[model samples]
Structures are given as C-alpha cells and as structure tokens.
Target: MAANENKEYSHKFDECPTCDGDLQYQNEADAECLNCGEVFYHEIRANRHLLWDYDELGWMRGVVSRA
Candidate 1:
C-alpha cells in the first residue's frame, strides 16, 4: 500500500440530468441516455469503490420472463 493511495472520489450521478430522455440500462451497473450521447455510471462510495445502481423497471422484465 502507498500513502498516496488513500483517497475517496465521488460521482453522485447515474443519469444524464441534461437530457430529458429515458435512461436505457445497458446492464447492471451502466446507463445511457437514448436521446443524447451522454453516459452515466454507479456512484462511488466513501471507500472510493464503485457500486452499481440497478434499474427496477428493467429488472421486472427479467423476473417476468423467468416465470
């Protein structure tokens, strides 16, 4: 471990606030604006680790299909 390795970065955004379009969930941890080319990712926690935000609407489809 290095002394300079201790840092926490935060990206408190998961959607394109500029584009007024529905966010298309690319997977479990990624999303993109269908209208614009803007991209967004999961938020970084206090440990500077990225944790994914899941789409509830998208997950519903998977559950229904598996049934």
Candidate 2:
C-alpha cells in the first residue's frame, strides 16, 4: 500500500484561488482569505476529531476532543 493509503484525505486551500492571499482558519470546517476577504467552507468527517477554542485575549487554543 502507498504511504498515504491509511491517512484520511483532506484538501486544504492554503491560498485564495482568486487573489492568492494568505488563508486563515476561521474554524474547524472553514477558512478565510486574509487579503480578499473570501471565506471557504470544507466538509469535515465525523470521525476526524479536532476542536478549537479562543481565550479572552483572542488567542486560539487547539484541543483534540472526539465524540
């Protein structure tokens, strides 16, 4: 089997397709383009477990919570 055969395949758009701007993670299932203000949504699998939260100071905190 290929090295990536067991890994779950997910596509991430690192840059904006229209303007080539930097992309920021808006949430677990969405990302936004910094320069062009474009938001992109992705489908997250139910078995793929990941969670993120924000503190009072607006810093991102990543947690692995599976349900």
Compare the candidates by lDDT and give the number of the best one: 2
Q: List model 1 lDDT by residue over 1-67, tens digit each.
A: 3443422232233345555666675654456777775555543334443433324454312110000
TM-score of each: 0.40, 0.46
In candidate 2, the residue pairs with backbone N, CA or C atoms under 3 Å apart (3 or more residues apart, or in different chains) clash, namely none
Q: Candidate 2 on 9-66: residue-level lDDT in tens? A: 2445566654778868765466677997755544435645333333456555443232
lDDT of 2 at 13: 51
lDDT score for residue 27 of model 1: 54
Worst 10 residues of 2 by lDDT: 58-67
Model 2 TM-score (2 dp)? 0.46
Deviation in Å, model 2, residue 14 alpha carbon: 0.6
Candidate 2 segments whose C-alpha is farther than 4 A from its true place = 1-11, 44-67
